[model samples]
Target chain A: MPAHIKNWSRDDLLLVAIDEGSSVSATFTQNTFCAAPVTVAKEHIASGSVRALLVNAGNANAATGERGIADARACCRAVAASLGIESSEVLPFSTGVIGEHLPLQRLLDAIPQAADRLCSNGWGQAAKAIMTTDTAPKTATRELEVAGERVRIVGIAKGAGMIQPNMATMLAYVATDAAIEQSLLNDWVQEAVAASFNRISVDGDTSTNDACVLIATGASAPPSANPQDDDYARLKAAIIAVHIELAQAIVRDGEGATKFVTVQVTGAASSEEALKVAFEVGESPLVKTALYASDPNWGRLVMAVGNAGIEGLDTGGVNIYLDDVQVVEAGGRAAGYREELGEAVFSKPEFTITVDLGRGDSREHIWTCDFSHDYVTINAEYRT
Target chain B: MPAHIKNWSRDDLLLVAIDEGSSVSATFTQNTFCAAPVTVAKEHIASGSVRALLVNAGNANAATGERGIADARACCRAVAASLGIESSEVLPFSTGVIGEHLPLQRLLDAIPQAADRLCSNGWGQAAKAIMTTDTAPKTATRELEVAGERVRIVGIAKGAGMIQPNMATMLAYVATDAAIEQSLLNDWVQEAVAASFNRISVDGDTSTNDACVLIATGASAPPSANPQDDDYARLKAAIIAVHIELAQAIVRDGEGATKFVTVQVTGAASSEEALKVAFEVGESPLVKTALYASDPNWGRLVMAVGNAGIEGLDTGGVNIYLDDVQVVEAGGRAAGYREELGEAVFSKPEFTITVDLGRGDSREHIWTCDFSHDYVTINAEYRT
Candidate 1:
């Protein structure tokens, strides 16, 4: 089933099959240039039903005019006809070069072979089939008891380059065997993704093909539809854990990323301000490069904070820490702060930066990675 | 004369003198954390009479609490005492690490020495002294006839990193021998900067120490102070030309930049939209890297345009070109486009990218540079 769609292959075409009559809820990229398949998927998902997904990796099929939409529709039709389902029941997805057409005939030809190899253990294979420039497959699973019934949740994601999802990642799929109401599943999918996938970044390029789909097969005893139920809360937590795990893995595997970084903004006036501060630090190239060199340059961090454009920001009341060692206290260098302490913390492969604005109790955190020369090399040579 | 009070040096103190009684107009960084010197310069320039500028390199004297203001005032005081002028008549500038106090004693000690070296040709040395990480001093001169009188305009600037001037560059000084009213000088300075320095970017990190000062010393027969005077237009044009030359030099010397790029956005609903779209493409790491690699990846350009947050942007109406070769027409790849054509254009040391929205008649342009591995290397190693 995992064929030429493998990473770095000449033709990154992918085909996969899933159970019929599955309950699915999904999220897609908010990028205005969303791909043709994203447009089709949004329209199809609005029907409140989905059975299968036909996805390819070589062409994103975006900005390709009316012809692109026709090709996506044709792909869905072929998949649905072969699987004995309605065309709208089969959602289509594409990722890779934008503004290119899909090789429909070749992709359709491989669907039969892919369907024959589908099995419960196809999660790992499917993960590989959907990858574009990703170096490794990203998958996470959790098993828990819901109302005394064994419930299982599995999630897979593929994003190594055009990251910084405004909604969800480039491509992600989560499936569960616990029965849940369609409406509740939709709400949980949105909330869970907002809490996890929306709180991480890699390159800050929101991909046009981003989509996250969650499916329920109802193969096991399920919890109540409402979160008021004890089992519902537990299942939600497990699902959230899977989402976070997959989200974090995307950052870890971020193209050319050398170090994992977590930025937490605390004591802001609101959650929005907290996230604004967090992104100001996460998306700053100066700060990222300094982190790459392990330079422990706290001034760059302060510069990023200043550029965050927070209104009425009391610079004098701000506090910044590299891990446990305080670097900036009350907006300036702490009285006894030493450069060596910061150097020691930043030299580590993973560290936390806590910025407390001391205005309110709101807090936000984001996971990111250091920018290195490899990042430029990878993106620069991607087309060549 | 400019002196080395560099950020990392043991001392980065500096001082310079100007003719007594100059009509001065100035602009400072809009960064909320504007440096202590910037705040004092803003107040001093409001008086329309400035005689000296005391600058340091090592510490930006920003985010340094009330003591930073006192330190800046002290430097100005010492300069004023030596020149027999009021402290308010002296402006201060500092560019280096933010949140660090100036070496008040060393800076005060150097004022007399700097004043002693003030010659008409001190422009060259002054440019070198104000540099923090700049590899070369940027200077431009223009001589023109205004109302049958010779008018000369000279400009010098220094900015290597953190060179995105939201208002003006890190530091730019333009002096003219044309007599003009205080109000006219102020209005013309704003207009000239908007057309020049404000349209260039390096890393998009608006520095805390940005300042541009324009002075008219009446050293030569001058044009009429009234804008309605025909000779005033020619003089303004010469001054604006000098500003652009000096501003473009900053981008040419952008930290580790290997190629210069000019991004032009046209046919938009408004000038604001044009600037948004232009910056979206100019600041994109993906686009910059592709340019660095000489890759004709127009899809990345399209992605940037889409992310510009333009309301009701019809992707089908957008057009893009690399140099003179049309890449995207009517939102998709131009019929005659070839990868080799883009590669050939991008392989050059400089080029232009023109984006046409085809929505209205508004247009805007920005000067930028390709992001390269050396950019990461330079910033990463700066602190070390």
Candidate 2:
């Protein structure tokens, strides 16, 4: 179910809190050019304790040298001191234009006042402040019956471009009130992200400041069964579900994106080969432009697959389909292929391109969006 | 020099002749999904003695099954019968919309009449017949004084997209009247093409039918001195000069090309690494679009250089320049860098991007064109 809680232009009561005895796990971008906020947050997360998070939009605070790091730290100190907690307990994040120095005095001056305005009711506001170019703030909540205890799991994320998970530029924050161990939560979050965020590519660029943190406050009543029992399964499922929704939202809001295109490669000789072909097909400008124009140019797809560095993919074994319509089979055009039919398939706002390598059993599903004039316009004028 | 003659539209007889006295050498696409033209061309060129070339535009006889082979043979037979030569002497080339079967009957009917209309002086006409989406036909001629005798070299080519020199769908024909041995001519042509045709890219796609053939009639009088003297040097230079002009014309006519861009990477640890960084910079859409918009976004250049798989490259030692302006220096933005200055540099219709890796001394060069809306337009609706 989707909820509408828009309009956060003035209210700044967005404060994150874990009611005490909370467990936390997080992962950040692996890019060597990571931003100052990402560096500070990861160091704080290493202590496995995060009581609150402060985030803002309009300045990415990346590539600004040592001064940027000092700005992020000062922000966390201001927020923590106002809340009467140790400075290490507060985490801060920023998103927006990179390579510009942040206005630290303004952020430092604002956070103490923001902490005084903290309320759990401001989850909606927290979602808004983290948004950059996203047209809508993405939020997902799930209720899970875990060993007779109901657990409330919610998540929020924001991203538009410089996205290709390793970890991707997209940032996700997931919170739940279930009692779980930190090591187990860490393992679970990594698995969930692997199946979701790691599989999507917006423009094949990995950003320098991508971070996702999952915090469990353990405020809910303990499970009726053993902690190591099947009771953990329900909470894990809930977290994975929320992650999927957030991941999908990021793809839908991709920079200058108009259509969401899913690429599913199946029957590859190996998962490596399947991923190679899938990435090639997803990244090809020719295929993306055709997708933008709503043209079912399957030849571009075939060309990309052929160019992927696979040694012995049988062209005869390749099969391509736009949705359920078979466009290519048995190494060539389908018997009744029609341009108009493909055009109709492409005209839809969303579609799946399923390619059967027909080689083995491994498969991969990659999510991507079409290349549009808007994408070029956004990136071409990004710095400006 | 450029010339004009009649015989492009298939109807004047002036010095028409066909002979299988010249040997042929070619390299075909390595893609397993290669089209029928590639398969047949490999067979025909293997035996050498490929003197006659029968080229047509408007339909690429590829992926059309057995009928493709028969149509190619029929086209050659028609041309050979008209000129009273063996059909085996004629090697055929086709360019244009691929996968559509060649209308063999229409072509076969037209070839005999076209051969009857052929004229030795119809260079312009022959050039026009081989054009697909090219806005203009290209022709180049050079005369050199070799061994006290005048040697002439003439060449023509056509290409726009589906270009990646693993022999892109580039078609080039060169005719010379130099008294060189068939073996020496084949060696020289390969060497010339390596530096000319094989080094240019349009859209980074390898076409199904890319051919560069040289036919030497050995009509020039004997040399005044040794075969291995400056006389040979002069003739080779003339041949290479013509090849370079033809190759440049293809790049100039690249699909939706607005400005011709040359990327030169030097001072790498190895030529392999130099080429790696050169291609990485060349293929990056961010760099290409920035070049298209003439924005001089040097940050994207730095990112691309880092992403290129060259190890031990000191980011601090990296330097970049657009023509004469130092855009990036010492691993970061240069001092006194201003957006307006970069804008001024990119405003030109043509410019050079020079990158110094600060490793050992190695260099490589690549030619490309700016990506534009027209490029998308041409490729997206290409088949239609």
Candidate 3:
């Protein structure tokens, strides 16, 4: 079973029925190669009101030139006409193959059916419909009691390949029934994504389309507290919780992946260095293969960390741990180390590998999975 | 039936011999992750003159700390002591597997027995011994008439993976019976490599240990005219021809490769931009898959060129030709372009992909191969 529920897994499209009091915001890919759908979504989200969201599977509608833009707009108009709202009030999302024109006829025919079945409660279905090559839909929801009134935040995301966040490839939608301004929601979503989605990588390739949207429907009672108060903390926590879960799911479902790994770099001179160190370790094929073989080869790990282009990293001060087992310390393999210890540590389906630079307090984390034969097979025969 | 000759196809280590009058020049990987053998070879090559070269397969004595350094020096010393030459004159090269101590005892035991069988002219034998996972040994030889004396330049290289040239991966040794100054030879070899070996990539990974050495044994008389004169053109041509052939052999032997591809980018704003555009197109997975499946997907070619970070690349000015058939022009699919033309173009065992930026006079050429399922299988299962 998926982490949340079944209703979402069965739905073909997302329903249009969140409460009227919601404010919507989004951040899209900044690449010059931005896709047509991304161009459309950015324009719609700028209005700060999203009455309903219409997303579909099986086509990404990217790289199809002007026709792609026209098709995406047409889908939104159809959804709005069904909901009896202005076309600008609906947001559309797509995930799947790139450089193909949208099947506008099929999508337009499905929107009325989708909006008619739209339910505020079907976050799970919304997640599934936006999936492409994703082994499972990712959904996370957290309820927080802020100022003695319950507030809930739900998030869903889909990605597996072409996933290395120069903003990583994927769509993430987080909705809440709270009274919040569009500006605040936008800032929070970007901040959360920067900390979570932006930190992970599966492949180094960046996609033409990438987006994260957050909606606040004002279904929950308004807090008496200001945006700077503990009420904001509760809201931020829910958003971050969902973002982290969705990001982890992307890693778990990483193409040709069998083991989930986390690389943490601490005691760095700056957050940037920490991030560089973490990503270098996360993306190394040697390190990934070691993870697959369940071999805690710290030498390869040290080699990767050393190559990260970080200045002034005292190699001697580096200490590496695999799932709490101290495998390397002080620029060398730990004494009394044995392959059996490494093998035991790697035997887990999920584990953490930590590197302490012993420099300062700055730190960063990267989540990824091992590269297996399946990744190659998928890519080699993809076009065929 | 090999590109060069029949007698050159097969040999064992015992049949190879070192040239006594050899003047050797070599360049090693510049990465701080330099392997132990790289360090030792740098010292040997820096010693002014080297006569004999000793190499062992199945262990790349790299990243093994002090022990690796000691082992590499020991191998050279063992060969020197047996050959009755100073240890500094014996250059050692190693390949295969990194970050582990070499089994020097086993190698030491094998060298003397192999040395007894060395013959003065066994270029074919030297080529075969250096191979790792290569289906065939690579050797390119050219004979040119200079000043009425025939000079033979035979070059050989070995590589299948971890091949991106910071210098050169796999060992390439070219021995010529041409009498030339070490200074001029060094300049000639470096310039030739920049145009040949440096223009290809098997994978983006640069190995820890990589060395390419050229040893010129001044046995033939000097040219009757100054080398700066056009009279030496035939000799220079021979060197360049051998370099190109040896470099292409590495590409032909690229791991899991089924098709060899040449990407030509022309009419760019600068040479750097042309190279950037060429490499981007050559390295793209989408383009590689199209090559693998023999699919005429010109959109992927345009996408790669645009993503190259090259500025002012008027998409409309872009033109892509798969062989003689124009698939994309005027920034879109060519009017009346046919898929059958593309298929026919790709069906050839070797073909050129030309991208015209129509921006400036700059151009570049890059060689690559299709990424197949075997590439993943070979790499993923290599260690196991």
Candidate 4:
């Protein structure tokens, strides 16, 4: 539906109505100044049975104070009325320029149109409609046979900038046609999100409206949702796979991103320390720009590692590798390393940088993108 | 002295020799992979009677393992031989690309030339000689009357990228023509550096070769060096003022910088918390990009504050200002704020962003530069 909420040029409203008796679980941004919609959605999801999700792009109803909360509730009520469901069974989400009030009347007038257009194959359109700076729609699907029944999981996500998710992405929804209990669904969603959305960062900025929801429709009644069942394990793997693909798609479509890179850190004192080192290297602007230029600057890499503030980190015990090419050993330029070798790795569209701390048996990794001139151009001209 | 350490075209060596009784206090980078020169300098400065400083700008003797340390000590020995001082009394410093071996023979051949060129008026030339990616030299000076005697403080610094200093800048030298006790000078240097170099960040990457040294010539000894003395206070203020001027100049001349910004966080639970919020706002890429474009993006400002990870922060009580223009109040857009007002403020080459947490009485501030297209270009092509 073209609500003309942000402007008169684009379609920007999407509503997803789940089947009755579906179990829902979600995670929201850890930002203290979370958006009004996030607050309302959290309260509504407490009942554990969400029937629909209403998302509007172009104006994130955030930093708008008391009136913003009321506006989010009003939109949820409009969607619920159109779907013939209670208001408490609907969740509302908004994304776009923050610190703006929602266009209530315009959004309300389009709710029925959105409900009228909803269909089983609307996932692609929904992904595009919820995009702010995303260059393409992100959607992933996985299917498997469990207990002689076909189980399917589908996921969609939308984000470009402000892309460091503390607990969730800017906006994501994963649905599966397999019966699962609420308690188990909650644990599975957290585990899937941890291995997927939480491992990617386009920029280090976390948004005010990040949220990821998982719905178990129970339309395909699998044999069991118990932890000890093979069916449960198979379904969980499919869900995690779909979530990872959707998360990777968000990074691939990141605003002005030219290259996709993976930062892998190993042999740390703990997983937390390893993550700290990976993030420091992944998010360093100098390192990102070097990646963009394909310079293979190991100097900036070592500088980023030194800046990670790992306690009692022995610089002499650290080593680094670009894919399979060993660039650094014992914290210095490897004797056999050549500039051309590193350049070959960094010139690729996607590559991984691995750092070995040589301290313990812990590891972590994250995916990120290079910083380009176009990144500055897009963000500088975003609100204009 | 153009020793052709990095290349054949540039003059990149400097030497400073002080009077016999000069008291010196210094700080080194907290980076675990600190440069070989930093390690040697720390050991030498511990003697409390440093006689000379040797600085080379072309190649940072960092991440070269045991050979790097030996090369740094060799350079110090050469400088000491030329100055007719103990090698242990000479401190060595290097700045430029990291993870590279120093050109020991070339640097040794130039030691005599550097010593011959060391004049009292070479501060400006020394500043320019120590630059790597910096486009301009940074120097600051102050003169005051202490105990009816004229005293002077002079400072020079060089840094452009990889400049989020943990304890000091890439390289800084400060000297005073007053009598100062070693203990007093040590305390004063820490205090001055904390308020100056520690409060600025160009990028969030810290270097492996950061060092700051404070020297007292004791040439104009007409007053007491005790902290309780008025003369001591007067001289300390002058030294701090010079340090601040040099620090701000580094930000003003930050690589590819078009604007200089100050982020001030007030009403935090403690000074550390205030600094955490200040640096979060100061170094946020989205905020910096908006600043470069001269856009009035208050939403990014609020988002940065929320992402600061301040425990139990009440978002509703936060307030933000662009200079005197109230952009945000009570965690939302200010009732009377106009975009034009914020635009006017951000359009200036220098501006201040103030955030009040409304939780306590503590405050802190930091200086930063905007992220521009050239920042990416310069870092991408730096080694090339």
- Name the top TM-score candidate: 4
Better of 2 and 4 by TM-score: 4
What are the runs in model 4 whose C-alpha is more than 4 Å off?
none
Please provide TM-scores, in order, for all candidate models, with all chains considered together: 0.96, 0.85, 0.88, 0.98
Candidate 3 falls in which docking quality class? Answer: acceptable
Computed on C-alphas against the true complex, the DockQ of each candidate is 0.65, 0.29, 0.27, 0.84
User: Which model is ahead, 1 or 3, in terms of DockQ?
Assistant: 1
lDDT of 3 at A178: 75
DockQ of 1: 0.65
DockQ of 4: 0.84
By TM-score rank, best first, the candidates go: 4, 1, 3, 2
What RMSD does model 3 have? 5.1
Candidate 3 residue-wise lDDT, A318-374, digit = tens: 788887788776655666567788788888999999989889999988898987667
What lDDT score is found at residue A63 in candidate 1? 75
Estimate, for each residue in A91-208, the C-alpha lDDT of model 2 and write its tens digit: 7776766556667766666666676666776666677767766778889899977767788888999887867766645888898888777788888789888777887777776665
Which predicted model would earn the best lDDT? 4
Q: What are the lDDT figures for the candidates, one per model?
A: 0.82, 0.73, 0.73, 0.90
Error of 1 at B295 (Å): 0.6
Candidate 4 chain B — worst ten consecutive residues by lDDT sum?
A: B222-231
lDDT of 4 by residue, B94-150 (tens): 998888889888888889988887787889888988988999999999999888889
